[model samples]
Target: MKKNIYYFDNSATTWPKPECVLNNLKYFLNEIGGSPGRSGHRMSIAASRLIEETRETVGKFFNYDDTSRIIFTKNITESLNICIFSLLKAGDHVITTNSEHNSVMRPLRFLEKKGLKITIVKCNRFGELDIHDIKNSIVKNTKMVILTHASNVIGTILPIEEIANLTFKKNIPFVIDCAQTAGSVPIGINLGKYKNCIIAFTGHKAMLGPTGTGGLCIGKDVSLKPLVFGGTGSKSDEDTQPNFLPDSLESGTMNVLGLAALKASVNYLLKMGVDKIREHEKNLITRFIEEASKIKRIELYGTKEAEKQASLISFNLKNLSPSAAGLILDKKYSIMCRIGLHCNPNAHKVIGTFPNGTIRFSFSYFNNLKQIDYAIEKIKEISRIE
Candidate 1:
């Protein structure tokens, strides 16, 4: 970790994860460093227990009673690919928003080239999309409605609850990409919302866990064909993949250490409360918007209203490239930010900054108002150049 760096790029990945989370990682490495669901050894059983406990807690987090259906994966991208490739056929169509991370867009684009029809609904210049636009985009052959809960670039929170209702009413399956809002905000979807929807999330970003940890909260009604077929710990005699939840998606050795850390992080979030975490980030964004708005050369993107956003802000300086601004913030101001399209070309196009991307500052639970104020001062000082 950089000693004096102010991390404002948490939307890409969080920093200074809770001590409990780190302790859990240490616990895994020290106490139980064995593969989950593989052997009958005590360490292996302990690993399995950790994974199960995390799944149950996550189920409770989303208000899902059945934890068995919670499938683990490498991250949101792998989870989305599992659902997309498993469900969508060659002639099927998928409807999604204009502001999607490459995690969703990349798989959809690859599937599109492989003969899957896709219709991307456009959001406004502020990265706001209307539910009616979704209704307008739906066609007879549409199979899935993939949604990004919040824009990674602009932090605009979408109307997912309404969209979930629409998908249920139309008997369409929905997949929400929760990469930007998972642990930082209050979202109790997956099993609580529409039964036909699947929620994909990563642990490293908002969940505050290590990388190589993430999964999909698969709903009761959705049955996905396994993308990776290999040996499951259960029914080792059978050559085919087992028809179970984690076993179905998880083929190779499980990341018990990572899941142990994730369990600790999720527990910490449960203790602090998602609402409180959300409020903290909102305060940071509010101060960020309030202070940065005074800079004459800076044009901020996303919803001007801080209450309607996640924990991120996107903006551009007049005449100064986003790369240059980010470099200056890093080298000169000791600040960090994400610069470029942010893996969402469609979002940039919608926000009218396509090829040249905006500088994105994503917030996390650990960020404070003082950091926000400092970042704002740095931006203003940088923009005052002759």
Candidate 2:
């Protein structure tokens, strides 16, 4: 809401989305107001075309070609829940990492209480996970493996390809929560090689799209039961839910307005290139870490190496709570950042910042080195406080 501040909280949800996203959303409201797949009228057909085109764009962005397998949801959390709950049941074993957000952890924990077995592969304090740990944790009953593509708290990118390979060999379904990496990092690079992987992504974080827009780029090998069932505009004669792609998983009416903006946002990403965006944000991370590390009292978390992480950095000043520093950065310096566990307490525990979490500064493609310099100066002043 406050556009005047230096926004560095892109990991939670990207702010100041691309101008095209806003423009297309306006166009959808003004020009195309119809429910996709629910009607055969001109406006409905136009809206359906937008959704399909956006699906194709998302599939291309991930290097995944099967657009039908991509099922839309409100967010990555819902996507992850559908994968976790639908794929696993009692007596089944699931594997995950310590760097996962609660989206993946909560569902697994709930299933664990219902007679499901869970193996939490531990990551190092740097939030780096070893693929060997995942391999060794697998058993005959291991049904699914769910984890985050990157740490929401420390911005550490996990060894996704390696883990996906392991799961493919084990014939286990691998569900990836890509809430932090969807538009900022290139995903599904190995989807062709790994058939058992499902990538759940949110549109708000790095995709430059509005909230309430996300979905699963499901692999051919994975078949999930519908998490929600309702009118899919098909098979109307029968009360039974349709057993197919997209429609089967999508019950309610599609978010045509949000998808119109998402279509524009992802097209913009494709044009700008995710790799280019990654490099730009990497520069910002490198600049901020280089200067923030100079303050002796500041305790930086994660691998500090810009290449090994996403565009976020977490730190704590000696004798200063993260909340206090966050307030000073917000009220005094007009810098917007996230503080506390960042919805991933396990990550904070892995990085030894549990309970009282660290201050997080997440960057985006729009961020620059000059903004990093200003944030560092403010952090330096804040660290000197008693």
Please give the range of 10 consecutive residues that has the lowest summed lDDT in model 2.
185-194
Model 1 spans > 4 angstroms off: 190-193
Give per-residue CA lDDT, model 1, range 1-386, as digits (tens): 45787998888778978999888888889988888888899988988888899998777766777787787888888999998889887789999988898888888888888899998898888878888989988899989999899999899899888898899889888999999999987775646557888888898998888888898887777888888888778888888788877688888887778888888888888888889899888888898898888999999998877888999999999968999989999999889899999988888888789899999998888888888888888898889775
lDDT, candidate 1, at 219: 78
Q: What does candidate 2's lDDT look like per residue over 284-368, in tens digits?
A: 9989888988998999998999999988889999968999989989999999999999888888888888899999999999888
- In model 2, which regions exceed 4 Å deviation? 1-3
Q: Total clashes, candidate 1? A: 0
* Each prediction's TM-score versus the true structure: 0.97, 0.98
For model 2, name the residue pairs that clash: none
Give the TM-score comparing model 1 with the true structure, all chains together.
0.97
Q: Clashes in model 1: which pairs? A: none
Residue 86 in candidate 2 has what lDDT? 96
TM-score for predicted model 2 compared with the true structure: 0.98
